[model samples]
Target: MNPPTSTWWTWLAVAALGTFHGINPAMGWLFAVALGLYRHSRRVVLLSLIPIALGHALAAGSMLIAGLSLGLVIDHSWLNRICGTLLLSWAAWHALRGHRMRPRVGMQTGFVGLAIWSFAMAASHGAGLMLIPALMPICSALPGAGGAAGAAGPTALIAAIALCVHSAAMLLTTGVISLAVFDRFGVSGLRTKWLNFDLLWTGTLAACGLVQLAL
Candidate 1:
């Protein structure tokens, strides 16, 4: 089925989120670069993107399931309010003490390990949770597209598209950055940045939450 003309903004949000996640080193790109350098092969870095995206997808899909479930049962207005509140709460928690929430990273994890790590890290960081409001707007817009066996088609399609777009963006960025770091200046290049990624992430979280609340 074709996407509604009115849904362009929704699609843009999905893609934008992907690009945003791609830019985040914690999303796995930095690790991929490290893995590449450790093995002295770019192939390793490229392959690492697979499980990284998979784990990210699984993490995001979990929230998609939750959003879909809620969309099917609750009124859009109420659902929005709930999501708004949740986002705000998460933002505050993250901003106040995001460091303490980081999942323990494994030092010896391989491909599968990387996938699991990505999933755990993304989930713990509320990456999926951040997408709820964006998805809810589109998913809830569909009338009768919830709860019923036949009702999920449109929402499912959108969610699937979002997953693909996000994964692709993350993979592309990971590949590019990993390669650049591998060939150019290595990890030291990343250190040139003065801004703290965590603080930036915290601010982003808060901004997204505020937008959700305003919506």
Candidate 2:
């Protein structure tokens, strides 16, 4: 067995995708921060990232499984349009109702609730879907990636490493940003600002989806 080749370009691609995903306002990191704020503990904030990372892993893993098992087929244009349209509809509904989806933080539920919420959010947004496809080629090129020989060791190792790196980057970036916002503005201030911007962000996502759909 040979050591799997590591490529800088692959790492960079993963980082880029993670960064891009981290900036999305609807991602669970924002809610993680809210969780931390609700508890008035930085410790809770840091701990909250665990569930977020797990959620990301779950999403990415699911995509990989689909691709490997059934050959995941995605029409990027169609998916984008569908996603965008859904976002837009959700936004419009919220706007009309003068309501925004807010993270629920309660003592009884605590960390468990946070984890479940993060998982659902990440899954719904297709957070890890893009990364898996982007990394698949590189992952498949590894020596053990093909056939039974590769399955037990090097190929699986490389895939796991890649997934870990990508997930870590996303979680770190999001966690830092969310924590910074909480520190600077405090919970109430952060909530107000996010709510105010939610409509705009939601609209933008919707428009992007629509454009993709149209294409």
Off by over 4 Å in 1: 145-150
Q: Write the residue-wise lDDT of candidate 2 on 1-215 in tens digits.
A: 54344656767876766765666656666676666766788887788778777766777666545443321234333444444455456546546642334455554456667667666666555454455444555545655444544453554555567677777788878888878877776656655565544555446445544543454
Q: Name the lDDT value of residue 43 in candidate 1.
A: 91
* Best prediction by lDDT: 1
lDDT by residue for model 1 (33-89), tens? 877777888898888899989999899888877866777766667766777777677
Worst 10 residues of 1 by lDDT: 142-151
- Top candidate on TM-score is 1
Q: How close is candidate 1 to the true structure, as a TM-score?
A: 0.91
Mark the regions of model 2 whose C-alpha exceeds 4 Å error after superposition. 1-7, 69-108, 143-154, 187-215
Error of 2 at 134 (Å): 1.5
Please, what is the whole-model Cα lDDT of each candidate in the order they appear?
0.76, 0.59
